[model samples]
Every structure is written in structure tokens, then in C-alpha cells.
Target: MLEPAEASPGTQAEQASFQGIRRICGFIAENFREDIDCVDIAVSADIHPKYAMSVFKRSTGMSLGEYVSLMRVSYAQALLMRDDASILQVAMDSGFGSVSAFNKCFRKKAGMTPSEFKREHRAAPPPLHA
Candidate 1:
């Protein structure tokens, strides 16, 4: 069950806190392709890093670093789907400092190396029937 905003001070504070979390998450999603950090996100949300981290963890059940890693891996997945990008380029574009680190993380998250993932996805057959 959920309480209405007008029901109590606690409810109102909860609502405001939820909104703040959403703003922070949205900012991260939008800028995840860039080199970003907890401080950057906290500044964008007009909150302190420690407070932002606490709020984000409460709402997302993950730390800001975990969220960023997931976002970066997701972006890499999208880039890997494209034929125009090399794995190294995708790594750099997704804000990883080095290809080895990117490959390690990609393997951890996607269960394969970036090159293998890209090749498998790129080689998939399209549906024949409409």
C-alpha cells in the first residue's frame, strides 16, 4: 500500500526524496557515455556526494559505481551491435580507460569478450518471414 502525499510529513519527504533519486538516475542515464563520477552526478543533482550516494543506494539498491558500470556495459553492448565500431573504440567511447579493462568487465557482464560478442550478434540471421 502507498500513502498519499498529503497524508503526512513523512509521505511528503519520501516523495521529495524519490524525485531526487529519479533526477540523479536520469542524469546518469543521459550522460553515462561520458567520463562521469559520483561527484559529477551529485553536483548535477545539487546534492553532496555522500548524501547522493545514500539516496541512490536506497532507491536503486546499488552503489553509484555499480550503476555506472552497468550503464557503461549497456552502452558497450549497443556499440558492439554496430559494425562501424572496433572493440577498442567502443571501450574508449564508453569511458573505459583501457581496452583490457573494458574486455574484462565486458566478459564479466556479458559472459564473453567484446569481439566475440560483437561477432556473434553481428552474424545473427534476420527473420525470413514477415
Candidate 2:
């Protein structure tokens, strides 16, 4: 998975714009641990929320809200992989205010509850010391 910073450069202006958008996306992904909304992403991207949503959707083929949700769910998937956190905690930490909302969105986007996701991708324990 290439971090936004890892994207290749292009023509000067194109590269600058691409880097700008990548920085905005990276900021959102990083701050996703906090309460992030379309307005926040818009401000980060230096555009009106409506315009940001439009351009972001056109560029990514998903609405800004949907993209944020996917990013949140993706982060939750990582936490679930550890098998050390509760689903509710994962929801809260991933920016979901309520478990029901989290479950609904998770099922809609991921086709499974957080618990099911965790079970499916549970990491193996470390080998015991001899």
C-alpha cells in the first residue's frame, strides 16, 4: 500500500496538484482517528465542501463521505486484525459515534459485522518461547 507521499511525480503543475490532493487525503487518513467531516476534508483540500465533494467523487469515483467511511472501516479492519479490541471500541476509535451505526455501515460496505471481520482476519499468535 503506497502512502500518498509515495506517489510518482509528473509534469510540474500536474505533480503539484496531485501532491496537493495526496496531502489532503493523507491528512484525512491520519486525522481519521478524530472527528472528521466533509467540511474538514474540504478545508484541508482548500475547496468548498460541495466542490470538494464533487471533485473528490469525480477523482476517486466515490463521494467524500463514502471515502471517509471506507477509510474509517479500513482502519477498523486493522484494529480488528489485532483481536485485542472490542467492536464498540473499534467503532468509537474509528470515528463512529454509535455501535449500531458502525455495524450498519460496516455491513453495508464490508458485508460483515466488526466481529465477523475480526474472526475472518484474526492474526496468529506469536510463537511461544522454547
Question: By lDDT, who's the top model here?
Answer: 1
Per-candidate count of clashing residue pairs (backbone under 3 Å): 0, 0
| Residue range 1-130, candidate 1, lDDT tens digits | 6548346888787777787788888999898878889999999888899989998898889999889888899999988998788988999999788999899888988899999989888745667996
Task: Give lDDT tens digits, candidate 2, residues 59-112.
Answer: 788887788788899998988898678998999999998999899999999999
- What candidate 1 gets wrong by more than 4 Å, as runs, is 1-5, 123-130
lDDT of 1: 0.87
Local lDDT at 26 for model 1: 92
Estimate the TM-score of every prediction: 0.84, 0.78
* TM-score computed on alpha carbons, candidate 2: 0.78
Report RMSD (Å) for each prediction in the order shown. 3.0, 6.3
